[model samples]
Target chain A: MPSPAGTPDADPVRASAGAPAADRAGGPAGEPLIEVRDLTRVYRRPRTSLTRPGEAVHALKGVSLTVHRGERFGIVGESGSGKSTLLRLLCALDRPTSGSVTFAGREVAGLPERSLRFLRRSLQIVFQDPMSSLDPRMRVRDLVAEPLVALGEPVGDRVAELLDAVGLPASAAERYPHQFSGGQRQRIAIARALAPRPEVLVADEPVSALDVSVRGQILNLLADLADELGLTLVFVSHDLAVVRHLCETVAVVHDGLIVETGPVDDVWEAPGHPYTRALLAAVPTLEGML
Target chain B: MLTVDGLGVRAGDLELVREVSFGIGPGERVGLIGESGSGKSLTALALMGLLPDGVTASGTARLGGRDLVGVPERRLKDLRGRTVSMVFQEPMTALNPLMRVGAQVAEVMTLHGVAAGRARERAAELLGRVRLPDPERIARSYPHQLSGGQRQRVMLAIALANEPDLLICDEPTTALDVTVQKQMLELIAEVAPALLFITHDLAVVASLCERVLVMYGGRVVESGPLREVFKHPRHRYTEGLLAASRLPPRGTRLATIPGSVPAAGRFPGGCVFRDRCAHATETCETAPELTAPELTAPDLTGPEPRGDGHAFACWHPRR
Candidate 1:
């Protein structure tokens, strides 16, 4: 792992920081990589169980969507709307009570553990906080290299190359997780996510923890990575501003169901759902000028 | 009315806020907008005597005619939850997780010697005032049980329990999602307490505040009515902050401030914003005072920068 440098934490802006319209135009659209039909996940409260009638949280209720190959699709919702649950289910980290998930048309929802392992690298997720996501004791290189190692791929010098790809200096891979700023740490997290060159990335609130100045930087980095790697990106966030700027299509989830799903432009200009409209009105818009 | 003059705070040898000053008339909403480490939250803490031990605050924060600086801790406590109250940024931390919502709120009135039954009654009223649904049911629920918005209303109920003359809300809506944040800010704006609101959400700041104070690196760079500040930010830092904000009419591309907020330990000897400023020059080597208005910064966008109430502080401010 590399030493986290430059900013307080996670200097997202320096990471090719955010996209210009030209940058968004880099990648062309492709076919459906992820297809879901009535996807649902029910989680029992932390320590509670199913036998005793626990406060069963219905995280996903009939979430259905088609994520085209190499497309940037954003899913937005309030905290409890099951966005996180859907991510976990798509990554095959949790089982859905009743739903169909066909990744690359392979019917992955009920795939056995052995089959799921092979599919894991194809669908990766970048979480909110790098501090919690990356192990503290591990060096930056090892953190990124872990995925490659797990996949039985020879890391060799690619760890240092990955660090530079995410805009961190090659020297960063040697430092512990705490040594980096928040933005730097998240970049490292991104490098680790890209280690296996996944076909799709479920980035859940990746930039929400970053400051506005750095947030733009992180948003741009994702756009560049998606274009360069030709990966389908499922960007999940509660911030409509982020969704509007980063994604081509959006799925607005509310109360465990998707209330509004459409292309970003139409939804932003003429939102049909009251919840989507409210979400739009709620975000503080920037004034005209640079 | 609330007025702060020459307010300076220090943690050891590092001066966090220097020569800060601002005022809010009764029922007027003012926003102190800045990013992390800007001392905006710390200023609110100083006004409420909530500064941690070892931190020294010097300056006069007068509320309604009483001098808050140098006021003894005991009197400050008495004044707190009664004379002046605050709604913190994180409702979860501000509230006790184990305690019932009613008890946390009722404590304010009870401390002022209001009877237990009456305090409980008043707690529900406060909750209802904040537009909380089923005040009675909400009163019984614990902090952990309430949603983020509900938890914030509970915090507001407690802050308004004694009906203080001033309410300082620190980034009150940061933790909330876009939808929830809008509702919470609207609820707070409608209540219209004499506010000294602090936030990084420039759009929310523009929407809610009447007067604006733009801080950078623990110093007041600009202060004025919202219309004036937003339209024509005279300070280079203010310009960067406004440009950098994800608010309406913003540049299509993400506008950046070149560098990050300078850390406190390495306080710059000159203008606080110089290291990261696009307009820095040899003159910045000598610290610039929060200067009086001279050059009228034409609104970079056009027509809205000035309605005669705006002001700025800078030696080399951008257009």
Candidate 2:
């Protein structure tokens, strides 16, 4: 078997340093970047009795959606709503039990690791907790350069460039993740995610862990990055108001199903479904109350 | 029914909380809002006399006219769960795993000298009051058996079992889902009296609190009637927080506070927020006093009652 670090030549479409911005911007609608068709994922719980098999958990029940190229799409749901499962399926980290997930017209649901070079290069994810997502032992430089290194790409001044893009000083490269505050650590995470120059940036509850004062900073950073890079963003959050702030279109998932899908403003203004209405009502907005 | 004056919490030489002063009137709800490391939780812990090992509290925290600072653990314990009770953020860990939910509620009353039989009966009643579905069945269930919302309701049941004069809740609904949080907030509002609700969510505070206290770097930077302070914040930190909380137009950048919060005990001397504030001047190197903002009208009377004045500590506050 080959070493853990794959050969750079294996993937021909390596993102060049200082790629031009707006290369993928201004794409017309109806150009689907990610298309799902009746996607479903099921898991079996651990067995408790000797006579019976483990009970099956239908995590995603016939979910379907489309993400347009260069579009900002948001998936909003509470815990146990299968939003995480859907994200994993989209990233090809997990295979669907049934149905299909396609990326730019190519099937990715059951693609093996070796066959996922394009998917891996085109998509990157930023997780919720910066503390757990970043490696504590590694310096900020190595952490940011990790994806590049793993792809067997050359280690140039890309680390510094990424740190700068994420609004961190060059001095941060030498520090460990613990040396930074929560917001700064999240910036480090964003820098690492962008190091690969992925066209699709999948952020899972990015600002949920940061303080309210710093939340806006991170959100602004993400919005600015997405716009400047012209990257298609798939943001998953539990708060609809937060999703509305960053995403143009939204899909509200509940009980492993898409309960509502529309422009964020339409859904916010007049929710059609009962669950959607209930969710909007329950959001505890500062609108008139403040 | 609770008055905290110059409350400070120290871990050895490091001052984690400094000169935090506030009050909660009889049956009035007040919120202590701050991000992590801002010493909001530390203030609650100090008031409860539950500071961690090697940490000591200074200054006076009077509950029902009895000073809680420097009090014996036994006396504090006596005061706890009767005169002043606390409900923590995570209900799952705060409760005992082995005990039934009802028994845990009953134990608080039994510990405070209630008869076992009466306590058991009252626990069921308290569970019902918290609006937990199937109160008897819920009482028999263990903490692990309940959902996050139900578990929080159970914690509320236990906290309210003794009908304490003051209830201190530290991010009580933060762990639940939005819908569940709404119900929990309603339940808390219906039950808790003289509440000191602590949370980082501005929306949650606005929904529940009549008064607000904004803490930053271990100090109460701003406090006032919720609407007035939120509408016209005097402190830069408070202004930034309210701006950040609102969802601006899509595609536009949010009005963000420039820097992250400094770690505890590492805040700059003098003004704790000067390093992050945009209006900081040379004079900001000296700490600004937490005084009521000057009013334009000369005929204005003296300071409002214990819990009702708009006060902030900022060298150059928003006009």
Q: At residue B294, what lDDT does model 1 achieve?
A: 37
Across A1-290, the per-residue lDDT of candidate 2 in tens digits comes to 11111111111121211122122334337478898878889899999999999999988877787888888989998888789999999999999998788999999999899999889888999999999999999999999999999888887999999999999999999999999999999999999989889999999999988888789889989999988999999999999999999998888777677767777887888876667777777888788576
In the range B1-319, model 2's lDDT, one tens digit per residue, is: 6778889999999999989888787888999998899999999999889999999999988987899899999899998898888999999899999999999999999999999999999999999999876899989999888888888888888899888999999999887788789888888888987899999999999999988999999999999888888998999999888888898879787888887787777899889999988899899999998985444245534343345668899889999
Candidate 1 Cα outliers beyond 4 Å, as residue runs: A1-29, A44-52, A287-290, B247-252, B293-309
DockQ of each: 0.25, 0.39
DockQ versus reference, model 1: 0.25
List residue ranges in candidate 2 displaced over 4 A: A1-30, B292-305
Clashing pairs in model 2, backbone N/Cα/C closer than 3 A? none
| Model 1 residue B315 distance off true place after TM-score fit, in angstroms | 2.6
lDDT of each: 0.78, 0.86
Best model number under TM-score: 2
